[model samples]
Target: INIIIQNQTMIAQMPHAADLNDVMSAIEAMRIQEESSYQCPDYLSKSEEDGSALPVNEECRRKMAEWCYQVVDYCKFSRETVAIAMSLIDRYLASNQGREALANRKLFQLAAMTSLYSAVKVHEPEAMEPKTIAGLSRGAYNEDQVTAMELEVLGAIGWRMNPPTPLAFVHHCLALLPDGSMSMSDREAILEIAKFQTELAVHDYSFVHIDASKIALAAV
Candidate 1:
C-alpha cells in the first residue's frame, strides 16, 4: 500500500504532460545513436556453439529473475533501476562465452549485486553503498567482492550502461497520446496502470526477446 501511494505521489509530481514531447524527441535521438553504435548481442536463444549459451536454463532463468524482482523491491530502488540491472546482467552473460565460470550460484548472485550497484550509481541520486548491497546478499559477497564484480561487469559490457529500456519507449509513447483525448483523472489512471504493466513485463523473461517499443505499446 505504501508503495502504491508513493508511486501515485511521484506520478502526480511528474512534469506536465506537455513536456513529454521534448522527452520523446530526446529518446528518439538516443534510439538512433544506440542503433548506430552497438548491436544487441544474442543472449537467451543463441546456440551453444555460438559461445553465448544461457548459463542457466529456462527454469533457472525464471528463478533468477524472481530473485532480482524481490531484491529491487526490498531496496526500494526505482523500476528503471531494475530494468537497467537486468539489462546489464543479460548483456554480460550473452557476450561472455565461459559458462562454467558463471555457473555457480554465488557468482551469479555477485553479478546481480554488482549490476544493481552499477545501475544505482547511474540512476539513483542517493546511491546504495557497496556494503549495503553486500549486506543484501547475506554475506554471499563482501564489499570488496561486489566492487570487483562491478569492474568486471563494466568491462564485460564495454561501459555501455545507458541502453534504451522499455520504460523509455513507454514514456515516449505516452507522451505522444493525443492531448485532451481523455479526462485528466482518466489519463493519470491509465498512465499509472500502464507503467505498472511495463514494470511487470521487465521481470518476465518471455518479454526479453520482444522489442522495447512493442512492449511499451502493449503496456500502454
Candidate 2:
C-alpha cells in the first residue's frame, strides 16, 4: 500500500539561497552525521505491514553500488559526473515509490538507467544519445517501463534542465589548488578521491543538506 502523506503544504516558490543561520545549522548537521558510526537506511527495508513491499535489499544495494562505480571507472567520468549520477539515484529514491512494486524489478532497473542518464547529461552531452539510453533500459527492462521512469525522474526534478551538482564544487576547489603546477597523475588522483568521497557521502541523509562545494573542499 502506498504511504499516505497527510496535510501536505505546497510551496509556490523555491528559495535560491540559505541565510547564515540556516547555513550554520546545515553545517552542524553534516558534521554530526559525518561520524564513522553513521549507517545508511537500507534501501529495501521491509515494513511490518503484511502486504508492504520492501525496497532494494542489502545484496541489491551492494550490487548497485558496485555497478555505479564500475560505470564511473570504466567511463573515466570526472568527479562531477559521479556526483550527478548519485544525486539522480538519491532524488529518485526520495520521491518515487518504485520500491513498493517489489514483485518486479522495474525500480532497480530504473535506478540504474536514471543514474546513467544523469551522468551522461552532465559530463558527456555529446556522447549521450536517445538510442543509447533506450538500449540500456531494453537490456534490463521494457522500453515502455524505462520511458515511464525517465519521465518520472524528469518530472520529479521539476524539469530543471540544469541542476547544480557536486562537480561544480569540485571544479571550484581544484582552482584553489596549485595553479596547474600539479602533475597530470595528481589531478587524476584527486578526481578519483573526490568521486569516491561523493559516493560515500550518499549513506548520510544529512549529507544532502550540505553543499557539494564544502564536500569538494574538504575532500581536497
Candidate 3:
C-alpha cells in the first residue's frame, strides 16, 4: 500500500500528459453534426475542462503563432485556405461516417491532415506537387499510411474543393469597411484574428458540417 501510494504520487507530480478521455470529449464537443439538434452542455464543459492545456509552452506559443503568421503572409494565402481545409475534413468524416482507412486513431489528426492536403492541392498546387505532399508525411510513417488514408478520405468525399474561405470574406469586408481606413499593419492584424478564428473552427466539427460559403462568414 505504501509503495503504491508513492508510485501514484510520482506519476501525478510528473508533467501532465494529455488526458485521452478529455481530448476525445473535447473532440466530441467540436463535432457539428448530430442526428439530434440538442446537445449536452455538460459534455462540452467536460471536454473544455480537459482540453485546457496550452497548445504549446508559453514562450513557444508566441513564437509559433508568429511563425505561422509569417508563413501565411509570405505565401499570401487567403483566409479561404483555412476555411476550405476545415470544411474538407468535416465533409470527409461525415461522408465516411467518421471512419478513415486506418482505424484505432484519433480522428482529429487525420481530419487536420486531410484538410491540409486538400487545401494544398487547390491553393498551392505548384508548391504541393505530388512529390512535396509525399515528402511532408514521409518516413514518419509508411508513405502508404497518409496515402491510403488520404485516398479513403477522397473516396468518402467527392471532389468538392472550391470552398469559400474567411480570407475571401476578410477581403470583402475590408473593402467595404472603407478605403484607407486601416493601415497595412492593421489589416494584417485583422487578418490574423480571422486566422485564429479559422483555427478554432478547425478544432471542432463545426467547420466540417457547416456550409462552405458560410464558413468564412462564420469564422470571421
- Candidate 3, residues 27-135, lDDT tens digits: the string is 2433332212212122223334556322322223233233333444566754345545545554554443443311323344544455555555556522233333345
Tens digits of per-residue lDDT, candidate 1, 97-199, equal: 3244346556776786678777767765556778877788887778888877888777888888776676777666666677888887987787788778877
Q: After superposition, how far is residue 134 of candidate 1 from its true place, in Å?
A: 1.8
The TM-score obtained by model 3 is: 0.49
The C-alpha lDDT values of all candidates are 0.66, 0.51, 0.43
TM-score between candidate 1 and the true structure? 0.79
Q: Superposing every Cα of model 2 onto the true structure, what RMSD results?
A: 10.4
Q: Between candidates 1 and 2, name the one with more favorable TM-score.
A: 1
Tens-digit per-residue lDDT, 1-220, candidate 2 = 0112232221111222335454445445444533311212233332324455655544454465566666656766443455455555545554445444343456665655666665555455234444555665557655555556666765654543233444444544454454467886887698678756766764344565466556666766
Question: Which pairs clash in model 3?
Answer: 30-205, 79-167, 80-165, 90-208
Candidate 1: Cα lDDT at 29: 73
